[model samples]
Target: MSLAHLVPAAVALVLSAAPAMAQEAPRWSFAIHGGAGVIERESLTAEQDAAYRAALKQALDAGSAVLASGGAALDAVQAAIQVMEDDPLFNAGRGAVFTAAGRNELDAAVMNGTDLTAGAVAGLTTTRHPIAAARAVMERSPHVMLIGQGADSFAASVGLEQVDPSFFFTERRWQGLERALRQQNLPIPERPAGAPGPQAANDLPAPPLNERKFGTVGAVALDAQGRLAAGTSTGGMTAKRWGRVGDVPVIGAGTYASNRDGCAVSATGDGEYYIRASVARDICSRIHAGASGQIAGQAEVDDALSLGGSGGVIVMDLQGQPAFAMTTSGMYRGAVSSSEPARVAIYGDEVLRP
Candidate 1:
């Protein structure tokens, strides 16, 4: 063959491979939320605000690092959430709020967009990382949801890290529980100095309907393979009773992903409202209907607000576009993408998008 003919053919082959090369390159993005609610500007000291921002930046870095390393979106989401779960500032694993019964009960959910498979755990008391347990449930168990002792046992069977229940205890969470009990005029249950026991609930105040509802932490990501995933973890509602499970562990309500539709979502807020509204799934559905991630996310958040639900959401599309919308005054959020530097914001005033 002539050299000229060979060059033309080679050029065509290189052009054909360009798209695949782009797809294979490390092009990914991640977004995470600590929670969302009425965070009054004057309420936070400068040091406190800085601390929250630092924590959020750390989470963003953790997730972005995974994606940059060509890891799966699911792994990125879990890695991001693990950072928040370990921090005493967010309401996930280590910082989970106490239930009305004076115990920390954690819930978490993880979903893979590529396969539409999901796993969740609720009322978890001893798992070191509830998000890991939720991942295990998705990967190892036939069940989509596991609760209480069963979930703990499954976590154990999988050899997920285990910790004493006290490992979840935080003084701030205990104070929040005490305040909630006081509001209800219920006597705080007394226990031996170091014994873990449920607080007596003659009448637990209806889950302390307030800003505390925004303590859940979640993350969503799109990885180099064009796959998407989402995960959410929460210390249920502060002062919740009767084994109440929130939207954090509910696939459609708190977390949803769809590689086919090209979007993933993670929500934090009033769990009941999120459940009734199917917030996360609804966002993905809107994206499927051709709306941008921001539009779909804001629309669902507005709908939830109109119904008296307060909270926020972080949405990421296959294109690495992120949309953060909150009905409340503030949402603890951060994002990182291949095209942009990491960004973290707490109050609405701090957010700057260009």
Candidate 2:
């Protein structure tokens, strides 16, 4: 049957035999993140605070509008991240992190559920939109991941703007790098205090974990055509080495979407644990096998932390249910749907305030 004729038949079938599916099909799917954990009240100016809330609303609105207008879920996901990437407050695009060598090496990834296709880039110094480059990598290249100058070169070949590395510099990140360097130099005791438990890597100088938390912004969407899509973007861990790569650009690590499974998840923080846990895709698989969105989202995160990982996640299930979780005190998050306008969450010290 033609699409126009098929629409009414499909609607009738859904209404009569699968009303739940009908309900889900027309609804909007959107979620956002500013950052996770311990964003002190004193740390943000009123203007900055307002910007966070505004960005969340805009991202949610854009995604919803796209889904409402029959746009692809992938388009909605990318559109939401583009908004965040343009905003300087978030650690993406314009305000991305500076490396240990004092350069910007951004990372981003995207996935399409219809066919399980995905793309990513790591250690990119400049490209107008790293997410777009990631999509290009997914669609145009035979490979799934690209790194360093090669990634940048691929992006340039695809017509993405290659800004100077200096464009990524910002005063806040420069100071953050300086602080991380100092923390690296602090001496460790010569030997174990008591027993020979695995001593911390004193000589390697791991970056402090408490610096501005490594929060990534992402979206999981159900488009008008009922397809699923997801994307994630980040500046990577603060004070990271120039060539350091994180889970943000890793498919199973930071982002995953599976239409048949009915859920998509995006993760941020402690890339090593995310990879070990397969955090994002695990959540989707759990939900597909009958776990609640809330339980599936939290369980994987908890599992990662049990193995010493710390980070937050945003998740959405086939039923249009949404959940956000983190081991941290709070994970800067928000959600919106046809049933509701917008709701944002943040931490007020030990308590979570919505």
Top TM-score hit: 1
TM-score of each: 0.87, 0.82
On residues 134-218, what C-alpha lDDT tens digit does candidate 2 reach at each position?
9999999999999888999999998988887655555555556667667887322222122122342111121223544475678
Summarize candidate 1's per-residue lDDT along 106-144 as a digit string, tens digits. Answer: 999999999999999999988999999999999999999
- Cα-based lDDT at residue 336, candidate 1: 80
Where model 1 places Cα greater than 4 Å from the true spot, the runs are 1-26, 191-211, 352-354
lDDT of 1: 0.81
**Number of colliding residue pairs in model 2:** 0
Could you tally the backbone clashes for each prediction? 0, 0
Q: lDDT for model 2, on a 0 to 1 scale?
A: 0.70
lDDT of model 2 at residue 211?
45
TM-score of 2: 0.82
Q: Cα lDDT of all candidates, in order?
A: 0.81, 0.70
Q: Give candidate 2 regions above 4 Å deviation.
A: 1-26, 40-45, 186-209, 348-354
Q: What does each candidate score in C-alpha RMSD?
A: 12.0, 12.1
